[model samples]
Target: MKKLRMICLVSTFLLGLPMLHAQKKNTQVELEVQQPATGLDKSLKRKVAIARFSNETLYGKGIFYDRDHDPMAKQALDILSNKLASTGKFILLERSDLDKILDENDNSNSRFKGTGADYIIVGSITEFGRKNIGDANLISRTKTQIAEAAVSLRLIDVSTGQIIYSEEAKGEAELKSKSTLGVGASADFDISLSDKAISAAISKLVENVINNCMDRPWRAYFLTVDDGNLFVTGGKSQGLAIGQEFIVKEKGKVVKNPQTGLNMELPGKEAGRIKITFTGGDNPESEFSIVEFIQGEIDHSKLENYYIEEIKI
Candidate 1:
């Protein structure tokens, strides 16, 4: 009877152990989630433009057919752009706008010279292979899939016509599932496999590029308004620094894009200096900042009367 009682106690303890451990682990995870991101120091922004992916080489070997669109290259570019933008330290020009600049360059009749883009990103990809791996004990019958993607990007400085940033990355993902499971396995596994790995590599590249340009004076604007505060709604995470001062310039009349027939806005006039009191959180929509200093009294009248003139020498 004593042995049975002891056994019952031991069984109950063993069963409860997992619950205690699970609770502890969950608490730890919650604490970690609540922790703020480290490295909150000022991050500098770069004026970067990314070009579309160009296919450099194709990979396939054997009697099997290999003919399909490789979507990951462009997908990777888009993801990289978003990740870079997320850092809040970049003036990212849209890919379409960059293409427009390129188009203008290729045109002989166009009078619009390049805006002297600081850095241009060009990339190419090579798809290596696709294979499956799992429960492959049946060396011959096991359907194994392995895919490899290689990417290379160049950051060209328009001023010097030099490649300031160059990086290359390659990744392989494996899909191992029952043949009956169909194509969903490929899509699902790739997303899970690549999101973590590819994003990390590109994040490092972006950080490196920004670090290289940390000392350069990036573009910034300032303002003084009667509202007592100015919103910094859009900026690369590294674009604006805490305590950095800006000279507010009023934006002028609207302009039209001749090719796409789009309306573009320009800065009209210089107002006064405004200093950044604090930085923001991650997302642009979620960014919150305060205007700590304004030089002059600004109201709707000042805004209406503002007109920018070229700085006299």
Candidate 2:
């Protein structure tokens, strides 16, 4: 009877081994799926512009050949712009017309309008190359190659020209080839590997940038004011919450600096406070917020210049 029991126990253990392995494999897959998203938050949308990326790599220095013809910089810029746009968290402006705007400003055209971008994104490709990471064994010669890409990115607040966030990220892809007993297989340098590495780095960098930028308070302009009711530019799409209080302020005057010869907007004075009461629901794209005056008088004349600053606390 004891021998029979032992045999039964061994059989059960063998049967459960596959089940345990399957559970462990499933747990690993779940962990991979739980990886954080590499996109910006959808709650608040911001207007942004992506500048052409500068190539700062050694290859860009023309040591071996002229770098002007290299497409790395342009590729990086295009990829980043596409990725950011895909997130749907930003209103990307036309970068192609930027030179025209600059030329207009240089020509002393007073009517050169701004791009209205809240922030400008600039970046440079610092490192982009591939290297061999393979070794030769006695029985089998194995070779591995790694493609790497690195970039430095910065987000500048367009209104203040202040760098709100900056980050650098690096990514790599590996290819391995081995020959055992005269049978061999090898992998060559693939362009897709470099692209993938750069894309991975950009994804991580963008995630970091958005996480940092979103910590700031949201701001909007007052579209219309009717007695105690107020209509604001943003709504639920901009992360406006019910019962949120906003500080009302009058628009400031634009003054030209005598030293730098640049136009600047003076800080506005706090008028009073208002709280969001209702928000548009059907069309989120055209969403607006309705706020009731909590402790301020509506100035009909200032309606055009009035704006709301979110209370962070």
Candidate 3:
């Protein structure tokens, strides 16, 4: 009877091996947990910058640690960046080391101009704690170490310099070790667990941030017009398919805002509509699309004053 029970357990374990392997092999693990079926349009991606991340929590401030601005803050920032990048929904700007990137861009033929961002994210590690809990009996002992973290995020519109979205999330990670007569498993301090906790916390906010940032219009700039052929700064890679039609709008008037001391652009007016006739380019930055004016008229000599926009649904 005992042998039969052992064989049954072994069979159960073998049956689950394929599922475990599949889970481990899943490439979409970096995406959000239980992601919804509906998602953003493939061609529409936003320009995002991680402006700042700070540690507001007292945790991880040891004698050797920089308590004024803890490394935990930077760690959280990196984790958040990875989560956002995984979604492939934004053109992430290197804000943490902008100067270095610019210098490198100057030295090389880099296409990145270090230009404006549609949105910027400011985040902070607000709370963190770690502790070990133990349970012991006559024949066995079990210990678990848990790391919990809370993160706050604020999405700022670079165009208006306003806080567009704000949210907070919490996450926890744990490691458990069990011993039967001190002959089983044991563990020491695991620093990587903290990172996992922070990552989990950041994951909770990524989808929301993406949705809020995408609530605005998408635009493609005019590269040039030559010999009656119009070229736009977007191509197939950006989800700009041939036969797609978009409105061309002349840029709005730039006016100084007395309240915020910022220069804001007024609403642009539709100048014409264009349909994508051809798309070429290897990547987003260098991509170009040839389009024909379907309706209305566009000024070829003053290309800077106009931009191509996706038609509103």
- TM-score of every candidate relative to the true structure: 0.44, 0.61, 0.68
Return the top candidate by TM-score. Answer: 3
The per-candidate count of clashes, in order, stands at 24, 0, 2
Q: Write the per-residue lDDT of candidate 2 for residues 73-151, one digit (tens) a residue.
A: 7778888988888876766666666534533535232323355566677788898888887677678888887779998
Which digits, one per residue and each the tens of the lDDT, describe model 1 over residues 82-192? 876786766666645555554454423122225334567776664444455555333322345565666677776553344667888776655554433242333334555
lDDT of 3 by residue, 117-227 (tens): 667787888889999999999999999999999999998765455678999999999999999988999999999999999998998998899889776787778888878
Deviation in Å, model 3, residue 257 alpha carbon: 5.6
Q: What's the TM for model 3?
A: 0.68
Candidate 2 Cα lDDT to native:
0.72
What is residue 156's positional error in candidate 1, in angstroms?
A: 2.0
The RMSD (Cα, Å) of candidate 1 is 15.0
Worst 10 residues of 1 by lDDT: 304-313
Question: In model 1, which runs have C-alpha deviations exceeding 4 angstroms?
Answer: 1-41, 59-70, 95-97, 100-113, 134-144, 177-204, 215-313
